[model samples]
Target: MNQDALSRELALRIGLAARALPDTDAKRLLAVLADCTGMPMTESQLANIDLATLKAAGQGEFAKVADDVLQQALDILKNTASEKILPAVQPYEEGEMPNSVRIACASDDAIHVNGHFGGCTWFMVYQVNSEEARLIDIRATDIPAGLVVDDKNIYRAEQIQDCKVVYVASVGGPAAAKIVKLGIHPMRLEAVASLADIISQLQQVMAGSPPPWLAKAMGIEVSERFKFDREAVG
Candidate 1:
């Protein structure tokens, strides 16, 4: 049979077996089937399969699909569930912890930044906070050097859900333009400097009112931080 036909047949059989079992059992069975077939089993397919067909095939016939392996996986899932060993959820803490901005610096020689922990030739990300500035995280990238800085090859914006501010830096041109189009501010800063000093300078600049051209380039606008009171999943 063709691959599609085989998949359809297997899906039909698995779905029938699943429907006859309890919710938990069905889920376990489906997981095993999915693993064996290397494909996910959808509820619609299960519903479409005729249970009578599966019954006619009988246990002996079903065993051809390695019923032992499926049963073993189901047993493991059952034991795990019965143990009640689930991840914990942590509630969101109250109060504004302060907002921080990231700065990515690159040069014409070779784009390099300080590693967060401690490593040369690494990407350094500086975070600007209201009270003080600090380094949050840094990573390593393979971007070559001597590339002219432009909207296409440098400076980008990162948008994260529930994040109040847009993250710019450690990116290239097209991505940066996309961020600006989304109404997110983008700032470009280079050279190694103390994180605190950078934040202080940024605050000073904003206090004086940004120049029209600079403000327009950065896509500056009023933004408020958002807080969610939810438990953290453990």
Candidate 2:
């Protein structure tokens, strides 16, 4: 299908739906759309789509794609007003709060670690220490119109270079390695979770004795971590 055949609104909807699915691009999604709703895709056909029809259409190429992901994509196709509400960022400055490490979360809803590292729409950054955690920034993953990125994973990693840790619902091994090489620890969650809950758990670990890796991320030497306890006993 010629890209020029799609109206601007239809094109935008297709683009958004494709982005919602992991490892899928506009061209691939267009093929699937053709199979589901016929060629010369239109807003009227998309608006009438059901999850059952989408699943049947996707069984060949998108069989491995999760139902939730398919549903999200379908939702975008159905609703022109499908904008996700982003959380507000609080004020923060470098070195303003000592002993805190910046953490990045791959999230689409701004409330949960629900996005794959490579495909997430936003990186919700938080400033966290042993005592508290606060949302500091929200970084969009959309590349600028003219800027070309050769390696998307590397570009994503560069976006959070200042962060000490990154949490995601999923990430490829190669992408994880790239993030690790940049001195940022990549943590893949087994299940979707609230960002606030994850931060609370991190704070708990920090309040006690952190493991060697966590210690390093927090810039605390393992040897010096228990010095205060030893001194009080002496």
Candidates' TM-scores?
0.28, 0.62
Residue range 133-210, candidate 2, lDDT tens digits? 768888999888999999999999999999999999999999999999999999999987767668878889888888
Clashes of 1: 10
lDDT of 1 by residue, 158-205 (tens): 312122233232444665566556554444445433223344566565
**Cα lDDT computed for each candidate against the true fold:** 0.36, 0.79
lDDT against true structure, model 2: 0.79
Clashing pairs in 1: 88-234, 90-231, 90-232, 91-231, 92-230, 101-128, 113-122, 151-173, 152-173, 153-173
Deviating ranges (above 4 Å) for candidate 1: 1-96, 99-123, 143-175, 179-184, 189-196, 206-234
Best candidate per TM-score, number? Answer: 2
Which portions of model 2 show Cα errors greater than 4 Å? 1-81, 226-234
lDDT of 2 at 163: 93
